[model samples]
Target: MDPTDAFFTQTVVGAPFTVLLGRRRQPGGSQAEGLHINLATGESRLSQLWQEWALLSHATPPGTARTRPGRVRRLMERHALWVAVLGLLSLTGSAVSWGLLLWK
Candidate 1:
């Protein structure tokens, strides 16, 4: 959802942390609180959400989302492969060293 669409620059009243609230019309023709996005307290989580939102919303003329993914996304996607490669390399190196020692 667009941040501006769901929320305005105004903050909610009497919140422990900075929160932006959006109002929606109820069936009774009264305004009701619709969204409550806790901005300051959940900054780290929201930062990722915002970055992902930017990657999705910002578009080139050709209509591609983005050339590069966010840091959190990149690490999450590659963490397993990198760890597996390191483990395999260490195991092979240890085997090779053991072979040489056994030969001597």
Candidate 2:
């Protein structure tokens, strides 16, 4: 599916039962779990996600000014992995540097 295209499904299922104290087996015989899926998407993705979400009063117009991501967010989005392996390696190196100073 394209990033712009969206598909939604909502399922409703429930089994109503009551429990009593000192119950070895279930009081009732059995209950069937009935579920159904329905699409909640409207005419367009913008209507369902953006407009209903109140992100904007209306659909985004052409050339709407959007705030640029900060330096840290940009770094995480580009070339870098989300896990931040470099951060862990740096922490290890810093610990070793501290150990060397103490060893002197």
Candidate that would win on TM-score? 2
Q: Could you give candidate 1's per-residue lDDT for residues 1-104 as a string of tens digits?
A: 47663454334433233222212324564432333466877533344434554576544644456579899888867897887898999999999999999999
Q: How large is the C-alpha RMSD of every model relative to the true structure?
A: 14.2, 20.6
Q: Compared with the true structure, what per-residue lDDT tens digits does model 2 show for residues 1-104?
A: 45233222112323434532212236663542222234674332332332343554465564888778899888778957645788888999999999999999
lDDT of each: 0.58, 0.54
Question: lDDT score, residue 48, model 1?
Answer: 42
> What is the TM-score of each predicted model, taking all chains together?
0.27, 0.28
Candidate no. 1 TM-score: 0.27
Give stretches of model 2 more than 4 Å off.
1-72
Which parts of model 1 have CA positions greater than 4 angstroms off?
1-78
* lDDT of model number 1: 0.58
Give candidate 2's TM-score: 0.28
Error of model 2, residue 27, in angstroms: 32
